[model samples]
Target: MKFRYLVAFVSLFHAFSSWASDSFIVKDIRVEGIQRTEAGTVFSYLPVKVGDTLDEEKATEAIKALYATGFFKDVKLKSENGVLIVEVDERPAIAQISINGAKEFEKDKLLEGLKQAGISESRIFSRSLLDRAEQELKRQYISRGKYAVKITTTTTPLERNRVAINFDINEGRTARIKKVSFVGNEKFKDSELRGILVLRKPDLLSWFTKNDQYSKQKLSADLETLRSYYLDRGYLEFNIESTQVSITPDLRDIYITINITEGAQYTVSDIKVAGEPLLPEEEIRKLILLKSGQVFARQKLTESVKLITDRLGDDGYAFANVNAAPELDHENRQAAFTFFIDPGRRVYIRRINITGNDRTRDEVIRREFRQMEGAWHSTKNINISKQRVDRLFFFNSVNVETPAVPNKTDQVDVNVKVEERPTGSIMFGAGYSDRQGIILNGSISQNNIFGTGNFFSLDVNTGAINKTYAASFTNPYFTVNGVSLGFDVYKRDLDTRPLSRVGTFKTETVGAGVRLGIPIAENDIVSLGLAAENTVLGVFADSPQRNKDFVTEFGKSTNNFPLTLSWARDRRDSAIWTTSGTTHRLFGEVSVPGGDLDYYKISYHQKWFYPITDNLTLMLNGEFGYGDGYTGRSLPFFKNFFAGGNNSVRGYDLNSLGPRDDRNLSLGGSKRIVGNIEVLFPVPFMKDDRSLRLSAFLDGGTVFARNIDFNLMRYSAGIALTWVSPMGPLKVSIAEPLNDQPVDRLQAFQFMFGQQF
Candidate 1:
């Protein structure tokens, strides 16, 4: 106790001496710690320089200003050697920022999102800034259901006042949906209504449907779906009143309820077309699908409006407007619908609009456009332009906008804005199959080649059993007259499936083709083309008949006309792997291989896509291909038809679906036909980026030696896995005999890779 009091007495004496004997008066000023900062800045912050009196008020303000610049960590004011001195610690400059454990985002993309948190590539680094960055990182993960994530920063000093920064991150498990409940609708069962909602409950096969995760955003969208479901069946006033969400005690689950109000049902009593017609009234009337005496369906009525407008647009009235409105007789419960149209005067496109092209040049889009200035506008030209844009993988979404000019009558400027998406990249792959054993393949090509928006490709594959090399090119805007040109050169050596003792199947071909394109309508394009080619079929191939007939089938193509009519049926698959439903795509074609003149050929293919859940989808495909001489002559060897393999039956080798001669080389399956089905889901262990997927499938189909009887072909079914990687979608499947064909193993599978289409 005595020592403490003695020490306190000494501290009190010193404190009193310091407070009493303060130094003040005129003094000089000195500044230090100034890198990339001006001395004048430091002097401005000081209330008085060397010749002014030193005081506490001036020192306090000076310190605050110096700190506000965010360039200094420590600021001080003192008198030394009869001069007032200012000292500071400058912030460390940023040398580099490295982020580890990032898969969902690219490095540059991650940096862009981090700028809001006071972190940047070219700025300084601070502990406070790091704390903010950690919070941002946490938020990004939480948004994706990764709530158990951790982020840490490491700062290492470097030369020249700069520091290297590294952020180590651990992204933990993604929260999954436990169950889902829907309430407040008695007309439809819970199961029926849930099917309409894109968000789904977890199932054992949820890996395929990805229906395990619940998102409020998806739920809100489901509510809209519910409303549309009712409205389509005459529930004109159907409404979703509100939605409520509740969280579980564990904070791992969420329950949602949607309250709805279903209005009265009604039948259509009248149909009125209240729009100007650019064509015959009867012609426009024929386009209407809605009729009296039928129930008012929201979808059908909406389609009617679109059809009417599109028909008008085909006639140079590109700005035609059509709207469907329902009038209800409350007492009678009858609804009358009117399609209002304003076929504003026929106008030509003055200039085409192109946007969202960061890497692609303006000429790229302009080159593919079918419509030009000083030409009459037509919806056919507009749609053709859209197809050209769609072929550019550089865009995630493309949209057309036509805003009316208030004073300008009969003319509209077309705006074609696209949401640019990354298209060019490299891919490397390796996979094993029963037939091919182990296959390795890769390719590098630009979909938007040379930024001209023209399609050009040079792809090669050399596997244990398969070798292929191909070069192809396509011009969307081949000429000002609306012609499109395509040409290809290729060679292949394929090992037929079932591993028959027959030697390897080989093909060599070179060709150049031209098509005369003519617009028929908004959704129709007709083309005619001719080609010259030289070909030879190798011996001991899948079928020996190929050599028997091929010597007479090589030479000139007559005309390839109406050769490309693509009909696609699709159900959007939010996830491609582990899929459950089907989307159907059908294409019809007529072409010529090599005949003197006007040779005709035809083909058709149908694909179905069905989704079982958010994570799973089922795809069924059918194709009918054929070619013959128009004047009853021999068809060109290369232009003749054949089908097999992963894209067709999944159990056969590439182009190995026809008859074989005594030596076992394929002649061909001129009237080729095939069908198949597949089920896809997500892969476990791989990060759930959605861009990556895994799947299993069963495919059964066969080529017809004769006409497509639809019943003569064999069937094969089995399973496989897939990965929709960033570079491409890789598919691997195993197939087995379903029809008991004389085989121990229909006993094989195939691998496929597709990037764009």
Candidate 2:
């Protein structure tokens, strides 16, 4: 019996030990070795709970779950007295990151990039993440053509299981494109192709353009441009075989080679329109730019499709589609095309939504919108709405979209969004001229005061020769039909004692006026104004006889009533950065019977801009002014016209081109003529920046005391720069007198800085 009991005891003890080795019934859970993480946090990630059978698979899964959290570098699980204990060796957190020897990029920008790569401070550290950060840095440098950049990283262990990372960089020279060549081309010269490319060898403009730098993105874009050039010129079968970019061993120079096949040019043999005709077939055919016997241009074909789709869109087909299908005759080198039109549905605008206008009232934007709710969606109206709002100059950008309404097949919503800009400004500027001396000026103006779309301004200008104080207010929408009302009060003082221009005299005037503007057409306005003024003239012995006679006839103090009539037509695409269109203004001011002086002044001004290319514009501006006395009275010399200034003909002294007195001093003129032809383009290498402009201009103008003489006109040619800086619009010109007379006072360099109203 003693031997049997011993054998049973040994077998039972072995079985109990085997069960504990394979699995366990957990009674509790414990987490250890975590520094910043809480025990409860580890328990939440634990796949096994207490009182559950914890086996080998469950323990492995639990360790994987904790490890995947990235909070720990190692995890181990064990069971003691039916309690599962999770032990984790937490990874070190990043305490700080520093970069050294970085000159090409901002430190904060580099830190932002590293943060995107999961290597920022306070984040868990990992060797793989560090490698990723290094690669990101390399990518940035490579994009900038810095192919020889070297980056070395160091990580130091810190207290509390933390790490500080440092990146030492050696940014080398930028790899420039040394050569670009073409292969397998017969029709076009290599020079022509290279000229069309954005990438080029170093040139005078390379310092600003950086076009000499070799970049994959730039190369790819060049390839696309080259392809487009071919396609637009009837090379429909052109194909690029291969492009090879080779860098020198030192990575400081790059060579690009392109192989292409320019197949035979094709002509359009025939054209037809297919599918449902939303409009008359003849009308649709008229919209097609490509005709039989013309070259097959992809650009023209694309434009034809767009025209058709736009026409359909105007007819309420908001999602119109037009695709041009081409049939080729390889032997004849001719192509026939068909436009398939798909007018999906007639859609109406269910609602008009406005957004991003925090300061402006909803009605302000709504009033500018031509597209109305509950009406058929019209692309033309929507575009007009966007243009109207943009022309206000109150917003940086205006975007419009017609998104289809959910669960509705024939309805869409117009979403008009705007980005408001600073519409109010306090301007302070100073300018100096030989005649005007030092001119100091300031103004406070708001184009959209209190978001009401009204304009208010107070202006003050003081100079050695002139002083003016004025305040004006305009309510653009005083009436619902776009009639505008404006009021202004002003005081002007002029002292010509120290100037050699005109007669030496002093004058003080005060005036108040009210004006009404009536919108006569979509782009035309008629303005009528009435003002009353009182003038006091100080005519001394040294004054000109002409001025003394006028003072004697009209007395030292006199009151005058003036009536003003003006008409304006503005069709420019934009008031600022105008690239195309024309503007015309016809103005006349007449002193009525109640005034001490009876005179009239009439002027006509016109401006036209033609876009020669995407980046080039041709502008033509002209102004003609004529003034004379009525009722046999003489015209006031002070009201006469003056030319030869920065605003008129450059390369001459300010207000210096006119009839001269016997003393050779300039006498004001009763008539003036000014004309300018300017070729405007973006500043070299700064095409993307819209605030700067450069123009080559030719100017011709002259002022006449009585009769006009074109032969007496002065001419100048020069280059001008316009920069819309934070302070104001700054203009500088360097001109050469083309046809200056002996009496002309030449001024080659002129600049003016003033804020826009």
Candidate 3:
């Protein structure tokens, strides 16, 4: 009430002043109430001057302009006896700014952004600037999963001219998903909701993908989707009663609770059409799956809407909207729903324009797009193309818009914009294993070769068994067709005795290979390859006397090399980091002069990812591989199959799988398989390009001499932690065998670093 009265009093004062100050001032002008603003500055803005007429309108104009500068709390202009008075209350200026409770971000950087927005040291500060700074800072934090935070700004008057500003930030706590529970859901178990919810608790294998990090916004969106699920079925009155998030004492862990009132589920008891039914009611009703007596289901209703839209589309009614309105019978707990569809008009695509990819070639996008120029645009095709672009892994974001074409009625043009990301990398790394000890790896790889989005790679390493030199290149687009060509040359040394990790080495392989890849569809691919190899496997001096008898039996000066054929299909989001995918590879070799040469190997791997929170996740990776017709004799000795090390099983020594070696040491070969379950969490300390992640894993696998005989194959399990660092990824594991083996040098425990693969 006082504020209202002040407004009225100010208005009356202005009216009276305007009427009274109409007289003229014909003498020297004088300035009063001067402070931070110079007297000359006021005189420069005033329209009326000495010896000139002074009017109320001119004074009012001067006062308004000063206030518009946004540097004053109050402004007044008075003229008495030819003396002018211009007084103003100056806003406090910022003397300095300090920040606290920040760990991931630097104070200087945040201050710099604030300064750019006109809130800086030695400058006046306002609540507006503080609010804006808070939002900007939060956006920066939210992009990296710091969703919950608080910012408080304090201002203290300083001597002479400014106020000290402090942005006291209570970053609160990082929200990590601890548990997600669903109540009153008897039809589907909590496990089902866990699969549906995008958020999940962090797992030991979280390094591969971030599945943890709770975001209220994201959770709210998911809940809406769940509600839609219920409404679509026949529960017209379904509602989410409430959602609660409880934090632990430390505030680091959070539990999510969702309460839902499912209400009474209604089945479609009857179907009918009213008012302007273009098609037969029975025909349209037949398209819906809500049988007259079936139980209500939100999933089915949603699908029914889709069916109606697609049915309308077949009749060239692309701009049609089909909505299902369900009229419930509360007495019977049933619903008779109606699809109130409104088909406005039929429209066609006019043109398709692509933008935002200044660095990438336009043809690259055009090739992947299913919708063409001057063609009927299918909604399904548009979404599929979006998925295709997202799967490229070379773009940060891709946006597609279909703007109505001007000067062309009933037609639209599609515009696509792409933001490119760095697609090539060169990594130099070193890894250690119980078998290899420490190994040096130098590699240069390019997924988008020369900005064309092809692939080329060269890798060199000096490690146990895998000591090799390799070079390869690939072209995803060959002559504008979805064809790829790849070639590689490599030299590797293989040693069968794993116990003597420092083995009596074998000098065997000198080889080359070629591959060709062709795309079958947007979601499918096929690859075929051929390779020729020459190897002379050698058994070293430090071996059991059985080796001498074996050599005499084979009577080998050397064995002729074999030719290999390989085929594979990889339908995964990313080869290095796949959230969901299926990868299959089959490689075989046939020897020419090496006694009925034949060897075949098959490997299959899958990964399912769930993001429990922005910073934590659960990752389950399952893998299985087997080698058939692998006599180890049909191929060159050096070409024999083997497995071990960090990427294989940690508890056992590398390649110590199949039969015993020359010195009675286990050498892994033949049928082999493994599995991994891991949880990932963000690192405690580290600000990085991609927030560093840590994880723990439990992996198990085994090997067999021939066909899988579970009893003969050994099983091992272990716990390993991995760190995805800016510099590189680091991993360490401690493993043990299911069945104890005294001679097993690595069975007690194992530790390794670098990549799991």
RMSD of each: 9.7, 6.6, 7.4
Best by TM-score: 2
Writing each residue's lDDT as its tens digit, candidate 1 over 482-524 gives 4557676666554443345332344554445454555544334
Task: List candidate 2 segments past 4 Å from native.
Answer: 1-22, 49-52, 427-434, 755-757
Model 2: per-residue Cα lDDT over 45-135, one tens digit each: 8889888998867765666677679898766676778877766789999999999999999999999999999999899998888998999
Residue 156, model 1: Cα distance from true site in angstroms: 21
Instruction: Superpose all Cα atoms of candidate 1 onto the true structure and report the RMSD in Å to 1 decimal.
Output: 9.7
The clash tally of candidate 1 reads 49
Q: At residue 110, what lDDT does model 1 achieve?
A: 74
Per-residue lDDT of 470 in model 2 = 98
Per-residue lDDT over 1-757 for candidate 3, one digit per residue giving the tens place of the 0 to 100 score: 6974686458446634634565677476665555576777767766667887767666666666765665665666666777766666677778788888878688788888888777887676676777777788777775445656777877788876578878777676566788988887765678876776777888764444445777767787879877876776666777788889887766577798888877877777876554443567777878787788987777777787787777665454566787777788999998887778775566677877887777777777787777767777677777777877777777899999877778865788878888998877788888776666678888888877656777788888777645888888887777567787888888877554555642344565667777777776665566766666655546767754444454555543444344555555656655444344555555554454553345555566666666666555677766666554454543223333444446665666665555566555554455566667777665554424343345666666666555766665455566665555554566666666676355554554555554444
Best by lDDT: 2
TM-score list, all predictions: 0.59, 0.93, 0.72
lDDT of 2: 0.88
